[model samples]
Target: QSIMMGGLIKKGSNNVESKIPLLGDIPGVGWLFKYGKKSNAKTELLVMITPYVIESDDVLAQYIKKFQEKTQGLRQGLGVKGSTAALSGKTDKPVPPGE
Candidate 1:
């Protein structure tokens, strides 16, 4: 299990794109694989990344469900593994640029 730098975005924009070293070098889904030399032994890595923390429980729950619904039965993986989400609460204010 590992937690490394993954995605970053601003405000309530559901569409935030980023380019990371090595990751952006690959094409399509191939971008998921960032390294070589996967040993023949058993290994596991469960990444935990909180994309953006918001202030609305309803939105948070909605996004969490979206993540859960998408990652179902994705078994093929390499040295890379991960999932992402936005955590929000009711009291937070939305940024003007993201509006």
Candidate 2:
């Protein structure tokens, strides 16, 4: 069995302002001659996964055996006990080159 984990974090901020020459600096009228905006944002993400390794042919064979055993009942129920080629539109024998 193997384990993997990952994470990411991001944070940012931005400020924007626009104004006319001298009218933007005026006392009360400054609001009409200038526009300003500020913003802040943060984001985070995390991920984890675990997997099993079949290191040898023996191990691989064992997994295959288990899968076949588990699916045998389903196959029997579906009446599909023989080769799957017919269902998949394939032929058991190879075809010759261009007729």
Candidate 3:
């Protein structure tokens, strides 16, 4: 997200810039422009405000249900202690003891 946000700043301005976000108000991370007449002049700003968000739904909603069903069926059909336990502990295999 840093790369994305930083790219926005690069495209927006060519003045002094800071790599950090939300710290644009800090000393040198960004620029502060001033213009006007007389001693007590007015100040202007072109601060960069970044936006971000979390996007997590397609992977979960799209495949989670299929993964659960396939895993459960493999356990029950094999009857190797099912999925709830270890297959090595199953005492019902047709082979003789250690054979």
Candidate 4:
């Protein structure tokens, strides 16, 4: 089976302000004499992903074993049981009440 996923991420915004030199800086009457302009620019990111599912347990196990062997050097402190749990789609932490 093949699964397709897509997402949009908005990163940042831009703001701009404009004012007359002498009139804009006035405290109370700044609105009438001076003008302030603000504009916002945002960055949009698109993420597309496709994942192929392994149907057979033996194939899945082989892939998991290969992954474990590759990552063994990097995962010195973490336990093998935790990795196995994640591979089996089992989380050690209990789910929250609402979620």
- The all-Cα superposition gives candidate 4 an RMSD in Å to the true structure of 9.1
Q: TM-score of every model? A: 0.26, 0.39, 0.24, 0.32
lDDT of 2 at 24: 96
Please tell me which model should have the higher TM-score, number 1 or number 4: 4
State the TM-score for model 4.
0.32
> Quick one: ranking by lDDT, best first?
2, 4, 1, 3
Any idea what lDDT model 3 has?
Answer: 0.45
Those runs of model 1 whose alpha carbons end farther than 4 Å from true positions after fitting are: 1-50, 73-99
lDDT of 4 at 14: 51
- Could you give candidate 3's per-residue lDDT for residues 7-69 as a string of tens digits? 222223234333445544567634443222323334344445544452676554445456557
Question: Which of the numbered candidates is closest to the native, going by highest TM-score?
Answer: 2
lDDT of 3 at 11: 22
lDDT of candidate model 4 versus the reference: 0.62
Q: In order, what lDDT does every prediction score?
A: 0.49, 0.71, 0.45, 0.62
Q: Pick the candidate with the highest lDDT.
A: 2
Q: Lowest-scoring 10 consecutive residues by lDDT in candidate 2?
A: 81-90
Candidate 4 has which clashing residue pairs, if any?
A: none
- Cα error, residue 89 of model 1, in Å, equals 16
Q: Mind giving the per-residue lDDT tens digits that candidate 4 earns over 1-99?
A: 434355575655455556777787789977676555655556656565546578998888887778767676456555432243355456777644422
lDDT of 2 by residue, 11-55 (tens): 999999999989999999888999899999999887766566779
